[model samples]
Target: MTHEPSGLKIIDRFSISLVRCEKRPTSPFGCKVGLRSVIIHSVLLCSSFKKSRKYSDVGKLNKINFDSLKRPDYVRTLTIRCRHLSRKESNPAAGVFRDFRNLDRLEIDRCHLKSLPSALFSGLQNLYSLVVKNAKLSVIPLDLFAYTPNMMTLDLAGNELRIEPYALRSLRNLIHLDLSNNSIDFVTNTLISLTKLKVLTMDNNRLTNIDFRRLPKTLTDLSLRNNFITTIHYVSGSVRNLRRIDLSGNRLDFIAGSGSINMLPPSLRQIDLSNNQIAFIEDKSLAELKMLAVLNLKDNQLTELKVESLSGPENRLRLLLGRNPFKCHCGIRWLIHSTEKTYPVVLDLSELNCSSLLNDNQKLSLTVADQRNLLICQYDILCPTSCICCDKPVCSCRSSCPPKCRCYRSANMESAQKTRNVVMCEKMRFDGSEEIPDTITELQINSVQLEQWDIKKLQKLRALETIRISNTSITDDQANSLYSSRVLMELQLSSTNITKVPSNIGNLSQLILIDNPLTQLTNGDISVSEIFPQSLKLEKNQL
Candidate 1:
């Protein structure tokens, strides 16, 4: 055979005799260059050919591809590009790729191959990965991966089409499957047989629902971003090994069965439900994800957050609720008062914009704006010699501490701080014999003898807002109680006398000064804030 000056050979040069009426498959390009020229091009592309040249079309990302090609090369990995295999030009001879058994990966990119030979991948036994991106492929045959049993990854992105049932049943060893950016409208058993699958990315598709109970339990990460998904039905029996799940940018209004289901697999660590239409989440929903460390709810439809929702034991959890329409009302007092420590809660309060408070036009930083928003106080509690102010917007001679600490509208006392209703206590002797009742809001004992305060059940006052004991050294339990509440807005105490302030402080109450005489200051020691009560009648012997 003779080669042309351009390095391409003509079919006529090979003297390949053709019968007058031989049956031949038509190529979409119109003309058949003959099997001889195709073989010559194959030799040119072979890596073992010492004189073979490497031809690459660099700027050809802009170039359109034609279909129906003969074999191009015999390499360890085959990359078939720029071919438009329409139904009329679908050549069965393309099955020649099956001869490349040593091939480990296959790429059919940027082509219009609407149909492929069923046996196209039949001989690629060692193939490890298969990629068919932007190929305009509309359907995947059931046995497409029949011969590639060792395949571990299948990336079929940008192929908006349908998949035959059991399409991937043969890929038993597959661990990663990506079907993103497709137009698939439904999903069936196409993935039910992948018992070993680990990572599945089905983003940018048209999927509207997902029944996790039908998926493989071996999955560790599953991403379904940017879809039309409105529901994700899951049971505890599914995804027992899954750790990370992402369902962002969907159309879900709320998490189905998120609450009351002790059914989420404990293996869960991260959940991303961001950029959706979610408006509310129940506390049990938060509790269902028991071991979760990260929860992202950014850019959603949430307006209010109940403090009780985060009363779970996951202290290390980092909740992301930014970009949502959060109304800064008394309903969110649990976060403002920092009572999270009571139930052990911490949130990623960064970038959380408040929509209802202050300037609605300008977004408020949740972390920075929280302090100013929570300056509300509502009690004029009469304290002891070492008094505490539980909740008094304008503290004075009038004592108004909550009698029993009841603000929560819900039966859950865990969120008592969220409600505006409050009660402050009056001065009472901490007579050890009284066995301080659990209902008291503030307990002020002016007992002088150290032995006088030990008889009271200080720890039993679960609802107690403040404890004022003077001239007595702090005990570990009492110190813990005080450390836990010494800084409480109602139990206001000077840091000069208090020890290390714990990092986990929930709510802080401000001293509300109502109609009363100004605090009489004495030396720096008697700062206006140090006075037990502005209305306390000064005895002649004391002054």
Candidate 2:
């Protein structure tokens, strides 16, 4: 009496409250109860009902028990919430959705319905969203939705659905379909015909293979999680145009991008292949994913990952590579000291765990950046050592590291690989006539120890670009070789007793002379008089 004075009905025994009244006919089959929403609290929904059923009358309202019944023919929205009734409970009836004419949204969750009559929903002409889940229905009865052609979203998860070909051919407007946590295995033309479909979720199914070539190109998001998918076959030049796809919890060992072509469409932005059996990805195939921005490869087998390989100018990808057994060795040095400009670097670098060869359970992790330095790290090579006659895999300290020297990448190299680099041979660690690595592109030293560093050895690094020397003294012979050096664009000298400029040093872009007493310009030491080349910036010195 307090709620709706005329058309509204609020039943306390059955816990049904109708919201927002819309005036319509009050007939048995007419949709004119004036209620916009129907909330059924405790109602025994049966498979069938007799005609003109009006068992419970609120006009005779007092304390009512179960078995309250109504025609419910005009209900526009209906929900049956029985979490304890998800299995088949037989009830002799003709059909469930017999006279629901104006129903737009219907949910039958947590109900045990063994089968549905073909014409169960033959009366719903305006239904848009249908969710029939947590039911033990193994098969979708033929033509069950033939009358409800206006359904937009079909969520039938937690059901034993053996999806057959053309199972959803009647749903032309359905865009989002969630059949996750079902027993449906392989996919057929059962779904490809829905050209308008954009998102499909079939996670936790028994699927083995999904023919990528036949998949709908119009689909933007597809999820096939927790399946037995090992190989994904697609054709060349005909890759699916998806924005995101999740294939997590599969049995994939390698990602070779299918036959004859390594192509992932440019439309794809994120891919999740986590918790799979993936050992490695083909490098050539990865580069084909040109537009990927986020990649998840967690809980897989990956040892040496060149971070630059997964990203480039076209794709600056963030990677999730946690829970993989990583070797703490030189193979991953490129990831540590790489100079290449890989964009959107991995944010989860801290989770990169290490498994050493000596003791797999030794609880080792990636050495901190400082400990990664070869000069400071290789001394102990705490990892198991191997001398494999040079044909060994990368990350073997004995195979890659020189006896003792800290190596760093060259500034010009723009990859996450340490292929082109320089070495720092501190004066204290220098012994006379040490063979400087031919790979060193720029050399730096604190003292002019020509006998130990061998200034003439600089000619070996044809790629050398810069040199910094805090010299104790520069001999005449050293100055002659230094001035004629043609590979240098920058040169720096810092010495308290020294002062000089190379005659032919105009070819240098920048010449930094730091803290030197240069009162005189003669005595084989030339000082700047007026000006020099355009690219030179002469710093503090005793003029």
Question: Considering every candidate listed, which one attains the maximal TM-score?
Answer: 2
Go through the candidates in order and give each one's C-alpha lDDT. Answer: 0.55, 0.60
| lDDT digits (tens) for residues 287-335 of candidate 2 | 6666778888889888656554565326556778888777654556555
Clashing pairs in 2: 48-93, 87-112, 330-395, 331-395, 340-414, 340-415
Give me the overall lDDT of model 2. Answer: 0.60
TM-scores for every predicted model: 0.56, 0.57
Candidate 2 deviant stretches above 4 angstroms = 1-74, 83-95, 236-239, 257-266, 334-338, 357-359, 367-370, 374-543
Candidate with best lDDT: 2
